[model samples]
Target chain A: MNKKRIAIDMDDVMTDAIGRFIELYQQEFQEDLSDLRLPGRNLTNTVPPERLEAIKQYPHQPNFFKDLEPIAGSLEVVEQLHQRYEIFITTAALEFEHSFTPKYNWLKKHLPFITWKNIVFCGDKSIIRADYLLDDLDRNLKTFTGTGLLFTAPHNAHVTGYTRLNNWQEVAAYFLH
Target chain B: MNKKRIAIDMDDVMTDAIGRFIELYQQEFQEDLSDLRLPGRNLTNTVPPERLEAIKQYPHQPNFFKDLEPIAGSLEVVEQLHQRYEIFITTAALEFEHSFTPKYNWLKKHLPFITWKNIVFCGDKSIIRADYLLDDLDRNLKTFTGTGLLFTAPHNAHVTGYTRLNNWQEVAAYFLH
Candidate 1:
């Protein structure tokens, strides 16, 4: 039997993208984000209106995606999942043209087991064909043909109705078990 | 009504990849390829076995894919098809790691209408979701779930199972008419 394919989103699903954005915000404004409240369904909404424009520009910076810390337990869980299913690290990299090389290199450095052949850099997730998609964005999930397993993230906290995986451990239990 | 999506291959379908390789081979080896016999199925088989390794390394060189001339009439035909169908310029770029930027840049420069969102840089075409896939490689077509429209090239001249389109004009007639 053919292995079931799972299309994995890179940003908030695998990498802690909002966490990186928060770090970039703190460094740029010289302010701690700990005091701020986490806004539901949109991380940028938590920041001051004036700073939102600047924070959005972070992805355009060189190496912005290069050093992103993977979500807690993602590496180990994804590594195990790789053996059981076809995992494609699909990301919406077109919006930030500069992120292409850095994101590709980051995957090469971090997930050395996932070969270049399985890494996909595209904009729309609707074109992806897989048995399942683990993504944080509800919009992406809404468009996908496969079963959408909403990976829990602050920006996607408001999303409901789809199966949610709070963390990589949950992801493991959902699939591996 | 939703427009039918067409996942188009980039190398031989949109760009003249083999033609560019032949040009590079002539320039590097200081030998004209005009006298060489055209092999039925594989373009590389036409070249001397001793030069195949060096010829394969051409894509690894910077800007090898950037300056490739688009296949004859592809620009006009695809542009017309774009208005009718959801066209995605999908290329197998993972094999050529350095090609990510160049291929993206090439599309921006040439097919500016096909935005970055519609462009996909992937390895296996089997993961693509579309109503129709127009590709030059028989292998890519064989794996695609949708209707595979074989785009004719010297390398695929011998392949005969699927519908063959000889040129861009033929592609236009097939889709538009």
Candidate 2:
């Protein structure tokens, strides 16, 4: 039998891209643009489009990916789960073609254990089919027909009525056991 | 001049109480008690009151806190900021005495570097005062008069118009820099 497939969200589920964007935006603009949303609601909108577009064009920030801290125990969990499941990253940053490349590179660099073939970047996650989907967004989770594990993100704490895992350790334990 | 004080939330901010409770309840009851809140409201009502009451009395799950993973970079950032500011944990789990003790003990044991005197456990955060408050709830943020750094929680992603930080590294850089 084929191993079950698991799709994971990127922004908050794996990397701290949203966190870094806000830091850089605040430094350059002297304004906190954390509340703004991207064209789609899946990703964090910490910088305005005009500024974000510009920032994207600039050479990737120094140690941009290396600085990104994975959600606690994410690396270990992914490593363990890889033994039983085919892991793929389904993110919503499709519009920014090259924007997520650095992030992908960072993920590859940091989580050398995860194969590059498993990474899938797209704006709409509903298109993907998997046995399990781990995401922080209710919309994404609702769209997925699989066993959805809602990663308890700070923003989504208000959301109720779902299987919520606050840390990667719980997620790992949930799947492994 | 007194340095600006930092107010941090406890339940999801520092401790994985919600996650722990769910995991333990599921193991004991053999039922998936995932959602904690009611369908439409932020209040926890998904788990029936009778079940919640019973679940609450179960022996404190020591491994729950022991196995918890901190929010990415939260400890390092908190420690770094402790050098310049009065890092105060102004959490709101004090209404239930039973719940508060374990959460407090978990944080105290995991993060011993934080001063015991600086920790403030209360039922409502609106009653507290601070220079800057890092919280995951929009309601709590709205109540505070100071600059509220809405921690970019997964659910709160839908809510807009606030300074948000997705992880502790960005938070530390935001305040320290």
* Each prediction's TM-score versus the true structure: 0.95, 0.41
Location of the lowest summed lDDT over 10 successive residues in candidate 1 chain A = A34-43
Compare the candidates by lDDT and give the number of the best one. Answer: 1
Best by DockQ: 1
Interface DockQ of each model: 0.84, 0.01
lDDT of 2 by residue, A67-146 (tens): 56676788878888988987776665433433444555666677776554455444445445578889988988885767
Candidate 1 interface RMSD after superposing interface residues: 0.9
C-alpha local distance difference test of each model: 0.84, 0.65
Fnat, 2 decimals, each candidate? 0.88, 0.00
Which clashing pairs does model 1 show?
none
Residue B137, candidate 2: alpha-carbon lDDT: 82
Model 2 stretches with alpha carbons more than 4 Å out: A1-177, B28-68
Q: lDDT tens string, model 1, B1-177?
A: 999999998888888777777688788878766533354635466678887787778898887887788888998998999899999988899889778888888899889999877988988888899999999888888889999999887777689999999899999999988
